[model samples]
Every structure is written in C-alpha cells, then in structure tokens.
Target: MARVMRDATVAATAEKIFAACGPSWLGDSYNHWSAAVKAWAVGATRSLPDDDRRAIVYKTQELDDALMAARRALEEEDDE
Candidate 1:
C-alpha cells in the first residue's frame, strides 16, 4: 500500500510538472501548479501510515526552491 501510494504520487507529480513546464500544454500556470501540487502531495502523504511525509515535503520544498532560483537567474539575465 505504501508502494502504491508512492507510485501514484510520483505519477501525479510528473503529470503536473509536465503540464506546468511542457510546451503546447493547457494547465494551471507554473506558480499555481506548484502550489496546487504541493498541497495535493501533502494531503496524499498524510494518508500514509509510515513516516514518508517528511521525505515528500522535503523533496517538494527542494524542487520549489530550485525552480525559484533558476527562474530568478533567468529573469536577471533577461533584464541585462
């Protein structure tokens, strides 16, 4: 059951990531998508009996931070 939940979360996250970043896609904007995905992942993780929520939350935060940093770098370049 834990494995199943993990797999589902991964699949869902991948789908959302692609929708947010892929070309020719029609989904939520990147900011909204990120927030929504984080919320959904946290809610889903809460259902697990084991202590996997910390890992998920950590990874999500890492991803968001990395993306924000990259975006800032790109914006700075664009302004130059």
Candidate 2:
C-alpha cells in the first residue's frame, strides 16, 4: 500500500507535481508521488522564529522542486 507521509518537518503540494506534466499524464509519475510525500513535510516544518520558518520552508520547497524535476527527467527517459 502507498503510505502518505505525515510529519512536522515535511511539506509538499500535489498541485505542483500534477501541473509539471500538464493534465494529460499517461500514468502516475514520480513527481506526483514526490509532491504528495513532500507536501506534508513542508507543512509540518516548524521554527521558533518567523524568519527561521521562512528559511526552512523555502529550503523544503526547493528540495521538493528538485525532486519533482528529477522525476520528470526519469519519466522522459522511460518514455524514450
């Protein structure tokens, strides 16, 4: 079974993942999974100060973006 990641340190959004390939995806991609998995991590991130929170959130977002991009590349490789 697919496990949905949940925690205070991870955050992600399926919207971004799904949008990466447009609406007409042939099947599930890594990006979709990555976003779902990462969304919660980003959401759960916590910091004592607002500035710290901002930095952490941005870092998480960037990591998620990179993972999504990597997934897209992998998918393309499989398609070819």
Candidate 3:
C-alpha cells in the first residue's frame, strides 16, 4: 500500500540521519538527533493539508523506531 511505502521512506530517511550523526559529538544539548529529525520531518510535511499531515503520524513513529535501530547498529559496529 502507499501508506506503507511512505512509512518505509520515512524510516529510511531517519536511518540515514542516524548514521550521518553518529560521527559527530554535537554536545549534550544537541544529542537528541532522533527528535530533531522528527521535528524536521514533520515540518517538511507541513505543505500537506491537515488530513495528510494527520496521516503521517504513524510514519513519524516509524521514523523514530528506525532511528533507534540505526543508532544501536552503529554502536554495535563501533564495538567490533
């Protein structure tokens, strides 16, 4: 379904963000990259109408989940 595909895209984007942010020590205040990415993602979707914006709530959650997974994977890689 289209919704599923869209969620997948959102997740992939979050994963990339996690990987890209892993190398930088952006300070404690800036450590919440997942949240920052979600905020950015949501804002990026603001051009959509109210209903469409509402539709991506689940997509945002998917992005958050993917971000966490990516973070763990990166940490494990560093441990290797």
Candidate 4:
C-alpha cells in the first residue's frame, strides 16, 4: 500500500538523520538537525492514511526521544 511505502521511507530517513547526528554533534546543532528532520517527516506523512500516518508519527516521536537522549549524552560529555 501507499501508506506502507511512505512510512518505510520516512523511517529510513529518520534513521539516517539520527545516525548522522552521531556523538560529536550536540546541543544547538543536534537540535536543529532533529527539528528539521521531524518537520520534514511530519509534512511528508500528512498525506498518508490515518493508520499509516499514525505509524509515521510514532516513529517521529521515537526519533525525538532518541535525539533528546543523544543531546543529553553530549551535554554530559561536555560537562566532563
């Protein structure tokens, strides 16, 4: 289905963006990248069916959580 395909693409994109952030990028830069990815994914997912949209939304949320975790780790590293 179209929804499935859309979700798959979004998932892959989110993973790549998150991976690119890596451990070296932190704070404002990390936040900026994550925000941009989230916005883009959300915009792309909007056209999907409700069920498909929901899956994409959850992945977005998970990405957000990962970004926060990554940010926190970066901050902690900075503190040390």
lDDT of each: 0.51, 0.46, 0.50, 0.58
lDDT of 3 by residue, 1-80 (tens): 12333655655655565455443333332336535554655657444443333344344445555556788899999999
Residue by residue across 17-56, what tens digits does model 2's lDDT show?
3344343332444444444445544655542343433433
Please list the residue runs of candidate 2 whose C-alpha ends up more than 4 Å from where it truly belongs after superposition: 1-47
**Alpha-carbon RMSD, candidate 2:** 11.3
Predicted structure 4, TM vs. truth: 0.46
lDDT (Cα) of model 1: 0.51
Can you write out model 4's per-residue Cα lDDT over 1-80, one digit (the tens) per residue? Answer: 44555656768865665565543243344445545555555666355454554454456557766767877899999999
The prediction achieving the highest TM-score against the true structure is 4
C-alpha root-mean-square deviation, each candidate: 7.8, 11.3, 7.4, 6.6
Q: Rank the candidate models, highest TM-score first.
A: 4, 1, 2, 3
Q: Tens digit of lDDT per residue, candidate 1, span 35-74?
A: 5555566656356433344434344444555666787799
Q: Stretches of candidate 3 above 4 Å error?
A: 1-54
